[model samples]
Target chain A: MDAKITARQVYKRYPSVDGGEITALEDFSLDVADGEFVCIVGPSGCGKSTFLRILAGLDTASAGSVTITPGADPRKPLNNVVFQEYAIFPWKTVLDNVAFGLEMRGVGKAEREATAREWIERVGLTKFAGYYPHQISGGMKQRVSIARALANDPEVLLMDEPLGALDAQTRKVLQQEFMRIWEETRKTVVYITHSIDEAVLLGDRVILMTAHPGRTKAVFAVDIPRPRSVESTALPAFSDLTYRIWQELEGEVVRAMGEEGQIKIEE
Target chain B: MTRNTLLIALTLIAWNLLFFIAGWWQPLWWLGLGVGFALFIWLADEAGKTAPLRYQRTYEVGLAVAFPVLLLLAWELIARNEILNPRWFPPPTRIAAALWDLTIHYDTFNKTSMFGRPWLFPQTLAAEGWPAAWSLFTESHVLTTLWRVFAGFIIGVIPGIFVGMIMGMNRTVRTMLDGVMSAIYVLPKIAIFPIMMLVFANPFGEGPKIAVVAISAFFLVAINTMAGVRDIDPVYIQAGRNYGANRLQLFRHVILPGALPVIFAGLRLALGTALIVIVAIEFVRARKGVGFVTFYYWEVLVTEKMYAGLFVVMALGVLLTFSLQWLERRIMPWR
Candidate 1:
């Protein structure tokens, strides 16, 4: 299979203040086919987010190679990220924030704004096009952030817990939106989340990663039928899939906690 | 009006009326003013607790307007009663009269006037070339200080922001400048006037005074702008880079706008410091500015003119600050 995104033996290490190297990711590897949505779930500090950053070119892997196959249009951006926080510029209006990538790439004003308006409309933020980030609610701001990434039309979308900061209600709405958008566009996505349910619902294959010196533990093909919404969480197959993934994740989460001294180790 | 609102208004009026009839007497005057102020605040706070959005703004403006009026009346009462020697104190009315006098007549001996009668500008310009017209404008006290302030402010702030942006983005540059900037920023700007005079060819001319003011504004703006730029949220910069922004695009779209509100705060501070420095410089060694006008009138013992001169300075500072705030709102409507 020709993969759209590739990461091989991706290793990341940081110099700890204690004068030793702390490995964030060790032997981390993944290959995602074109138009595939891959979700990786792990405890915090597992370096799942680190791997996404490497793939997005925001961070570097110390040892391995990662590349995204560029689209036919040379000018199309390689990748765009939706960060954990609503990283949209506070000073820009919703329309301007969405148009920012095109503007930076030297697109003409009328054309960029038109494209931004369409994306804003698609995200249901048409009424807030002229409003600043401060004027909008957190949910609306995240919508703007998502629209901003989507408007650029990158070859791959890297979401590092994009819905992590939202409330449960808003998260559900955005998760459904994400599934609908993915179904429509089928763009390559590397989604990092702490929620197994989210991974089972959104990804073509769910990749579970072990914590601290993070490495891939298992990959589960979703195989569940589409046209899925939050309603799919009620299905036995979805629940079974989520439970099985969580079973693998449970040991890692505990080990992560014991390492942090939040939960004591008896042995 | 609600009882609290009416009571707040009535308390303000009653204080004014009581002082108007009773006049200001030392212990009683200070005590009454203090007691009345506290009572008025209580009423205003009581009014605010239930006031609708529309009426809250009215109370705010009312409180603002009343406090200064009361201060003016206190000044009048204190001077009229000979409590503070009116010759030096000069009640507000006498100061107003002195201001009017300065406005109407040019003081040929001092070579100064409030505005040099701008109504004659067309006639003057027709009869005279640039030099003559320029000389005529420089004779006005208000215009003289204003020109020096504007010139020094523009000269200082432009380079200040440019250098500040440089220092902000470069760690080495910032570290190199930080210590010296901190030292100079606190030193009294008026103390530098003598050195600035030695540097200029014409010590007594406009050069040294404008230079001193410019220097004061420079350090203030440079340091403040550097802080403003350095303090910008880092995530925005990351977002800019991730969006395919080049260096110039990142600077334009992220760094500058992110630093703007703090930069404007720096501007407001620099403007205040600039005015204070120029006025002090004029007081020591000049003949055509508001500070010089105030000092000259004091030398001749026309105390009211001195107070008028001071009034003009206060008005200039307030007017400049308000103008800066308006410009800020225009530039950063996002705020």
Candidate 2:
């Protein structure tokens, strides 16, 4: 399979308040094949979000390069992000927010509005297309955020814990929605999350990262069959795979806790 | 009667008895009235404590109306009995009468009226064209003040937003202007009237007055716009850029709308400042604005007319505020 995204030896450093440099990512590398759904799971402060930002070109890697191979259609954006905060503009109606990316690309008003309306329908927000973001529920806002990213027709989608802010039930429902959408479009996606269930359920391949100057620790392929859904988690193989990945992640999480000595494990 | 009601009735009776027995107004009698009023209020409060929940709103409305009416009655009585000088502090009734006179009195000599005699608007329009009709409509001191405020507010707000947007986006510009803006913002805009007068060719014309109002509005708007722009979420800007928005598109789609709520807040503040500065300027120099009439009435010691002029100023403030709120609703429907 051809790689849609390529990254090599990526590094990120920030100037700490104590006047010393703090490394966030060290010697990180990733290559996502075209139409692949990859989830990067890590403990807190593992720099997964930073990596996503670098791939989205919102931030530069301190070293090495991240690039998205251009598709045959040059009009498409390289990547579009679905932010954790569901950063839909409060001033814009749902339809307008969905059409925002197209508008930014100089798409004609009628065409963009039509496309936005179509996406809004796809996200089951047709009735709420005229409503402002503040007037909608958090789950609905995330749907608008997702529809906006998709409407941009980007080569890659970068999501940073898009479902992290939602309640458990809403998160599960959206996970199903996301699965269905991905099944339909097969767009290359780089999803970051702290939830193990989410990573295992959504991604074709789950990549684990270690904490403190994060680097790829392991990659697990889900051999579970195609057309996955919330019911797919009921299969014995699903829990076996999830348990196996958790075993790998648990050691890194414990090592990270020991290194920081700040995390309090709650009941 | 209920205990609380009886207590309230006795308080009122005692209030009347004290004034009737005095047969003459005294400062001491006022003290008696105050004590009786306090006792009555206490009794009313006690009565309300036991009232049904459904009656609470009614009780509140009654108190709201009765308190202000009672105050006005006291003012009328005091003024009529000459306890306070009526010449300087005319009663509300006299002020109302004066306001009515100002509304109807059209001075043929000065060719001006308080409200331009709207009753005669059709005649003016038929005898002349739309210009004359508009002139007649705006010939009042009220309209003159309104026009100045509206003009100055627009002139000040437009550029204020522009400069504020630039200052908000660029750190270098913001830092360069921060101290200067703070210094000027704190200064009283009226203090610059003399300089404005010197700058304009005609000191008595509308130029200097409008300029003062504009300057006051400009600083407020510029400062507010900068704050608004700076307060926008960085994520939105990043999203806009990632979606292929050029600089102008980014500004139009993201920065402008994102900062609009704060900008409107600034516009409101600037509008109020514009009204204040224009009034002060009119008080200092103009021959035909509401503020000018107010000060003129004071010079001639016509306290009732002076109060009427103040009432006009208040009315103008309300009218302008309502108009701006209407505009704000139209511009920011999402809010």
Candidate 3:
């Protein structure tokens, strides 16, 4: 299987308040194949978002190099990102927000709007086309953000906890919609989240990460069939994967929580 | 039928009794005339109300019309009767008459120094006759004053915004200039007028009045603009960068838009400053301008002319403010 993204060892260091350094990530490596959906889940501040941001070329890795295999035209969309904070432009209408990427790519107004309307409707935001970001709910804003990323038709879509801000019910509904959208678009996606259930539901493979000098602890193949529903989560296979990943993550999480001689892990 | 009607009747009786006792009118006839006038006013207010509410409509309408009318009458009685000296407070009727004559002679008055000098000031016969618009137009002093205000505002605001934006964006620039600017901003810009006069004294000096107006207005605009630019949010700048926006694009899209509300605020302050400085500058030894006309009237004791000059200044100020408010609404429709 051809890998879409290959990362050798990566190390990232950031400055602390005391003029010393804090290591965010160390000796991190992962491989993702074309058409694959990968989800990364860990405890809080595990540098998952940092990994995704680096993949999106928003930040540079201190040591390792990340490379993407050439596939689609580079001029089209190479990598698109949806930030965690519902990063829709407040000044733009929902339609304009969705159409932003196409507009940036120099698409004509008519063509951009035409294409944007399709995705806007797909995200169930056609009714909100004329509304500004502040007028919409958090879920709807995230939908507009997702539509914006999709409008670019990128080869790789990096999502940094795009659904983390929504209410639980809305999150579930949007997750279901996201699967349908993924099936329709078939874009390679790398999703970062702190939720174990979200990782199991969305990813073909789930990469478990440790905190404080974050590193990939293990990669588990979901091996679950596609066209999956939230109901699929009730199955034994889903529970087994969740339990196994949790089992592996528990040790690293303990180590991560420990300082000096004390090692305490919260349930 | 309503409490308002009763109240109005009572008010009319009271006013009529005052008029009768003061010997301005006969009690019976004036009382009847007052009642009729009150009824007419009440009807005008209640006609639009579906229920014909008595007290509410009459009270609202009565306040609106009667307050100003009463104030004017008091002013006229006080000023014309010398209760308040005409030099200090001209009668409203006399002001109205002067305004009418000014309107009639506006053309000639603008071109000629119709109100400027005692000899140039028209005699009773000429003053009574309507003058040509050419005189008003020929009065270049108003033009000169206006030109100075416009020039000062432009010279002050352009550099102010440019510098303010620079200091606002760069921490180093901000730190370097913030203290200096604070000191300069508070220093009375008008105090420099004497110095300017000494420097530009009588060699093509064109009088230091214009320079004085320019300087005072400049510091006001500059201080406000710096505050405007410095107050822009960093998130806006970061957002622009995330979208692949260059420095220029960041300024054009985010910084400019963010700074606009504050800049308009500065402009408003600067406009007022320009007006004040222009008047103050022209107060000292200037030969022309509304300020000069006002001082000239006061010196020769033409109290009516001075009041007229003041009225003109007030009218110009109101008109300018209204226009700027309209433009502000048009540009920032979202706001």
Candidate 4:
């Protein structure tokens, strides 16, 4: 598999209010292959979102470089993001929000509308295409967000805990929907999440990171069979893999919580 | 009868007896009237409390209508009986009659009419072309006020939004202008009318009046637009940029829409301020506006006509508000 995204020793630092520098990411490197679905799971403030933002070209690394190797089509956007908040414009209808990326790229109105309608239909939101963001449920809004990212036909998708805001049942349903969509498109995606189960279920490879100046802890290859579903999570192999990843992440999570004063460690 | 109804009936009888039969037109009689009214209101409140949920809305509407009708009746009675100085505080009927007179009476000396006799618009159009028909509107005080508001509102809001956007996007610009803008925002716009008059070449022309109105609107809109732009969620801007939107596209797709709701709020405020500033300006100088007519009527002790002018001002406010709401709905369909 050819590598489509490469981040070499990325570092991010922010000036604290007290005049000292706080590191967000330190010596962070990631390589995502073509047609790969990679999930980066970490504790809160682990800088996984920061890394995704850097890849999306929304922010720059303080040190080092992150690059996306352009595909054959120059017209296609390099990457599109699925924000955690769903970030859909309240002033736009569902169809318009879905078509926003194409519109921004100067696509003709007719072509963009057609494409947006097609995606809306795919998301089963055809009936709601004319509805504003405020008129929709959170799960439905997130679907629109996903459809928007896909409709742009970008080379890569960067998702920042897209399903994190949803209830458990909605999250599971969307995870299945997302898996099905990824199976169809095979677009390279870098998904960030705190949910270990989500990382195990969605990604071809799950990368775990340590907190406080986030760095890679472990990378686990999910050798599970293709065309996985929610039923796969009931299987012994799936549970064992999830358990192993959790075992690797548990110490990092506890340490992070302790540092944040959310938890106390005994000796 | 129910206890509440009985109490209300007794209160009404007591109110009339205290005024007519007792011939007690002193401070004590007035106190008795107040107590009687309070008792009636208490009975009404009790009735409202006991009303069924489905009938609650009917009760509210009844209260709304009854209070205003009762107040108008009291005013008519008080003015007719000379309880208050009728010359200064004319009854609602007199104000309505005065308004009717203003509508029909065309002043030959001033060459102006209240509505330019809009009833004659069809006849004017038939006798003359569009220009002649347009003259009917131009020769009215109402039209003058409307023109100033519309012109000043447009002139102020457009550049106000532009400069506000600049202030919102650039941190340094925002820092530089924040203090100055804040200081000016709270200053009463009417206080600067004298300066505006001095600045214009014609002190008594439309220039100073419109400038005062425009300046009032500009500050309100600029401040509101700045807050609106700054208040937009940063994630939307990030999404726009992430999707390969350049500066203009980001503004069109993200910033403008995000700021629209707040901008509309500002527009509404600016509109109200514009009306106030124009009226104040007219009061101070202009010879051909609703405010001018109102002040003129007050000067001549024509209380009814003065009240009519107040009525016109209120009507203008309602009309302008409705027009703005219509425009806002058209522009922001998603809202």
Best by TM-score: 1
Q: Compute each candidate's TM-score over C-alphas.
A: 0.95, 0.89, 0.72, 0.91
Alpha-carbon error at B20 in model 3, in Å? 11
Model 1 chain B weakest 10-residue run by lDDT: B23-32
Q: Model 2 over residues A188-267: C-alpha lDDT tens digits? A: 99999999888888898999999888999999997788899988899998899889989999999988888777534421
Residues A97-184 of candidate 3: C-alpha lDDT, one tens digit per residue: 7887777666899999999999999999888899988788999989998998898787788899999989999999999999999998
Candidate 2 — which residues are off by over 4 angstroms?
Answer: A255-267, B1-74, B81-83, B108-111, B128-139
RMSD of each: 2.6, 4.2, 8.0, 3.5
In model 3, how large is the Cα lDDT of residue A58?
Answer: 73
Task: Give the winner by TM-score: 1 or 3.
Answer: 1
Docking class of 4: medium
* Candidate 4 deviant stretches above 4 angstroms: A262-267, B1-70, B125-135
Candidate 1's C-alpha runs over 4 A off are: A262-267, B3-27, B47-51, B122-133
Per-residue C-alpha lDDT of model 2 across residues B1-335, encoded as one tens digit per residue: 37767868787787778676877455665865577668767776876787789999998898888877777777887787777899988998999999899899986766778888888889888988689888776679888998898888888888999999999999999999999999999999999989988998988788888888899999999999999999999999998888888999889888999999999899888888888888888888887889988998999899999999998898788787888899899988889
Better of 2 and 3 by TM-score: 2
> Weakest 10 consecutive residues, lDDT, candidate 3 chain A?
A258-267
Query: Which window of ten consecutive residues has the lowest lDDT sum in model 3 chain B?
Result: B112-121
Error of 3 at B260 (Å): 3.1
Per-residue alpha-carbon lDDT of candidate 4 for residues B9-82, written as tens digits (9 for 90 to 100): 78777777766767654435456556766876887787788788999999999998898777777677677767
Give model 4's TM-score versus the native structure: 0.91
Model 2 chain A: weakest 10-residue lDDT segment is A258-267
Candidate 2 positional error at B211, Å:
0.6
